[model samples]
Target chain A: MCHRSRKTSRIRPAAGAETSKTIAKERLKLMIEAEKQKLDDDTLNQIRHEIGSVITKYVDIEPENIEVRVTLKDYKKRA
Target chain B: MGKVITFTSGKGGVGKTTTTANVGAGLSLLDKKVVLVDTDIGLRNLDVIMGLENRILYNLVDVLTGKCRLKQALIRDRRYQNLWIIPSSCSKDTTPVLKEEQMKRLLGDLRKEFDYVLIDSPAGIDYGFSLATSDADLVAVVTTPQVAAIHDADCVLQILKKKKKDIRLIVNNFHRQMVKDGDMLDIPDICELLDAELLGVILEDENIIICQNHGEPVMGKHTVSEECYRNIAGRIAGQEIPIPDYIRRKSIFSRIFFKNTAGKLV
Candidate 1:
């Protein structure tokens, strides 16, 4: 019964550039949250668990670097 | 006033005997007098599958050779009161069920005594297959949806059409996921390939294996496979119950969902 809006803007620089990697990490986190909101809660949970496992198994990033947000909306029962 | 239905598979191990036992049990559940006759001679297995092998002292061979009366040869099914079976002889020295007239006579006698007669035919497109199916008022051609199974089934379909047999298709062991992945053939593809109407579609249910292992018919009250076989029997009995959405896959949403989601999970 509610609406959701999410946005992610990432600014990553090429190697040896002045921009910090922390900025890029923050932007990636924002984009993932936006993508997550577009999916239903169940699908989002599945994707998060699946992606988390794959990333943890293969990616070099620290586990604490990932951040997620989920919002619940108004509830109504159908007749 | 019931029909004689024969279950024939051109390829072996596609559950012809199991289907006969289940559908016969299903029909008997409907209070129809049912008889299941095994025509798979030399390599007999229906009696064993039906759990009546030990009770068979006299067999179809005995009646065919005039050694025993047909009544003495029929074994009552242990589960259903209305169901009976005439098992085949496993002895290698017996005569093959080769003559069409002899089969017609046996079926004629069975037709008089039972409301439904289900014959489990021998495997392959040989004399055993033809003789078992020749007297059927309705023939259910079973296939397993592989290239080899479909090819052999097509050969049998051609032979049955050449003989002007009343035939329909029952696509057995249908794995819907595999079919969606294009790894296995679907029911419509089989029916179109054989140019035959579909009588029923049985999903790949593990309960069939368990039931067969336990020597129990799949037509028990709670089993889904039993319901499918009963629906097939109902269709054969000329009842117009539309094929349920699951079996016929008639719902647009189901078809689109299956088509779209197939093979994506892996």
Candidate 2:
């Protein structure tokens, strides 16, 4: 027979050192950037150019203003 | 109000349209009312994927512009009674034609009527993508195992993360054979790279392409692909269903001898 002696249970923090959102974001950015760099520079440039053209046509922004920063896509900033 | 889930991809030919169509059909299988809106604008493929091109009376453009009512624009699915699709305009010059406020208003109205509004967003991280996913309750980034698709998906994820939007991932066209042979990027690789919650994975099934060509979604194929979509739909509807990621190839010997483990025949 088992006795019901579970009254001492309490909530506690999770195991391991928790990572902050900012650090996690930075780490993810680095990983993604590394993966993107695996592609040929020529192909990456062509894709960037294509994105610039679409933005110029639809958003009416100059090519210079249409920065294709691989850090974060502009839609998030705009939203 | 019903939830609006947007299916978007960073690159073209990444199966965004097909995923949206299948998810809509799967949701309908659960007796939930679902409307699939083709927001691809100029490069619309949802109509062709769903095989409802000839039935298109009006489109999202017409509904937004007041040329046609929202209900009039929706084409009821030929098979699923609870499913509908709002096709996109055939005009390729429909750039910058849709506005966010108008879309929000249209979706707001739609939310009151349906159980789910699934938007088939266009590829690329441009204006079209922004407008399509501006007001989405959930955004799913669909990607294949290829490096190009994965890189773009990462970029898309960063953007969504910056906006603090809830982001989910769907790994499509995943081939277990390739993954087992270490020839293709696996699911954990994708999840860790993007650092996003995974909604589901759709294994490589020729039936999906065949169904698209025939204008029928894979959800009705009753194959492993169908099971994938059904599980995804159940998850989308807030049900606690385990995603059946491991699918075994149909062979009597393998079935009789091998224990199926994560899409491998070992």
Candidate 3:
């Protein structure tokens, strides 16, 4: 019973539907971003400062106005 | 000195021990002297899977505690002459019996004697995982195609990156057909998501479980799983064998006109 039969037929996905693999990848990406946001205050501040510096190089942006949030809702909405 | 490679996964039941056992055996098949150290203390199963359970007179705890010499604790594999295993203690206490410093010293000694020292780490990112990877020259993070496994693997990868350890990813139990059907993540997607070098991928074959149940590795057998293990071991031994192309997602044109023939697109 442990033998995996190679005869299992492949089932094609329905057109225009999101595949399970895509959903899984998106979920994992969100989970990883969420986990990364759990960094300590110092690291988060450093990341914020770095981001502010990078943005300031391109355009005028206040450091205080730059907020980095790893929210699943926003990511899902963007997707 | 031998290279110390620790096989770890942040999640359980993702084939870490199986990869360690078979990769160790595969290294030995390539005429390299390899010793697999089971660091999953108190829950050791590598001995049972390697069919050397009855031969264990001394465990890793005994060696670490100085109850026995290092050589006395190593159980030689029955199949490969150059392969051996150091099983962890199977005590009920889940506390890590081997400290990080002691593990490094033990690995130092192992490095002088073998060509490859493979450590089978326990599940979770706890003390046991730290001890297993404390002195690893390379860490192979094993994960399946499932989202949970991939997420956990990413967490582990982040930790390893913090430690500045050289890391690689091994995808286990990959169903190529499922990937083709868009039901499972493909190889490239996993490599990109994990952001680690692809060590190798093991297809979802029932023979892996069957071989483990038989207390033998599937490395030398003429099976797809065996070839996968061999390629992994070859890569570990610094060979340049390319990963099989069939594991990658086929293009629409190829899928429409061709079929998989013995693990190859035709």
Candidate 4:
């Protein structure tokens, strides 16, 4: 036989809190992704312009590491 | 058997009533007999949004308590021949059609007359929400991209899962420019967090609010909002509509382009 006794329940953090945190995390991730996309697009466009300028200026010289490095740094600084 | 769909959100003012009204109008345009039941008692707006407020003589409470028959309480849409509504009674008391058994019986009776019964559920997981969903064949969880709304919607989704109900998501009031600018929750992030099948994602439109205030259906060839509603209605009616590439594949094409470039470089 079991004896009857009253037991009080403890309150935990509201369920909505956890869900809210997760939604916040996902939103942050989306913002980061969108920003990264914009940056990448801008970087690509910059690179294209830099490569065109480099080829136009050094048409006589063959493609080499030193020229590309100098051009990339100049483009990065411009950006 | 007729399909009963409930539009619910745990948070308020996320356009549940508006979506219900527009979807009802869209379904009606498709030649289906659609009945929208406003379950938000004490705060009914489906009638006003659908432009049938002045025509109401009987209400949901009257029908539930047997003071009037269902036929008497239903307010037919003047704009659509097959669309109708049972407006909620504005009462201070929280008790509006409280019994689950009563809702089951009422819905069972409603199924005989309409092709689709759309219940605009009250906000939160309370007595009203339970009653509305208990009679639903499908639950359309309406949500916006705002942090609070998404979280509340997720809570509602969890409860619906616990109850073993089939649910589809409708992400409404999304601003595309905000998503593009990294200021708002986009479709992909929302779906990832909720992990539910998204039936539709409606973009934010001022016209929706204007249409509601003017008591008109956002249908026909005039508005983008109407197209979104029509697409949702078509999907509900089992039409295999191609989910627009702008919504589903917004980032996918960019990913592919990056992958191709990376592969070539490596």
Q: For candidate 1, lDDT tens digit of each residue in B56-102? A: 77877777767889999989986887999998875545456347887
Which stretch of 10 consecutive residues in model 4 chain B shows the poorest summed lDDT?
A: B257-266
Off-target runs (Cα >4 Å) in candidate 1 are A1-79, B94-98, B247-266
What lDDT tens digits, residue by residue, belong to model 4 across residues B148-259? 9999999999999998988888889877778777899767678779978777867677656545544666675256666788888988887766445343344666445323
Query: What's model 4's TM-score?
Result: 0.72
- Window of ten residues with lowest summed lDDT in model 3 chain A: A1-10
DockQ of each: 0.01, 0.01, 0.01, 0.01
Report how far off residue A12 is in candidate 2 (Å): 57
Between candidates 1 and 2, the one scoring higher on DockQ is 2
Tens digits of per-residue lDDT, candidate 2, B1-266, equal 89999998899898999899999999999999999999988666787778776687788888998998888998998699799999987553554867899999999999999999999998999988998889999998999989999999999988988888888888999998898788998776777778777788887776665455456786644565777888788888877665453545365654433222122100
- Residue A8 error for model 2, in Å? 53
Measured with C-alpha atoms, the lDDT of residue B104 in candidate 4 is 86
What's the CA error at residue B65 for candidate 1, in Å?
1.1
B-chain TM-score, candidate 3:
0.92
RMSD of each: 26.5, 20.3, 18.6, 29.4
Q: List the residue pairs that clash in candidate 2.
A: B246-B263
Clashes of 4: 0
Question: Model 2, A1-79: lDDT tens per residue?
Answer: 1111222222121355332333335544753454344443445577789989988888867887777855444322221
The candidate 3 chain B region of ten consecutive residues with least summed lDDT is B257-266
TM-score winner: 3
Question: TM per model?
Answer: 0.70, 0.71, 0.72, 0.72
lDDT of 3 at A62: 76
Local error of candidate 4 at residue A60 (angstroms): 99
lDDT for each residue of candidate 3 in B1-266, tens digit (9 for 90 to 100): 78999999999999999999999999999999999999888777898678676677889998998999998998888678799999887655565556778888889999999999999999999998999898888999999999999999999999999999988888999887888789998777787788787788888876665555556787655567878899889888887766666644346644432232112211
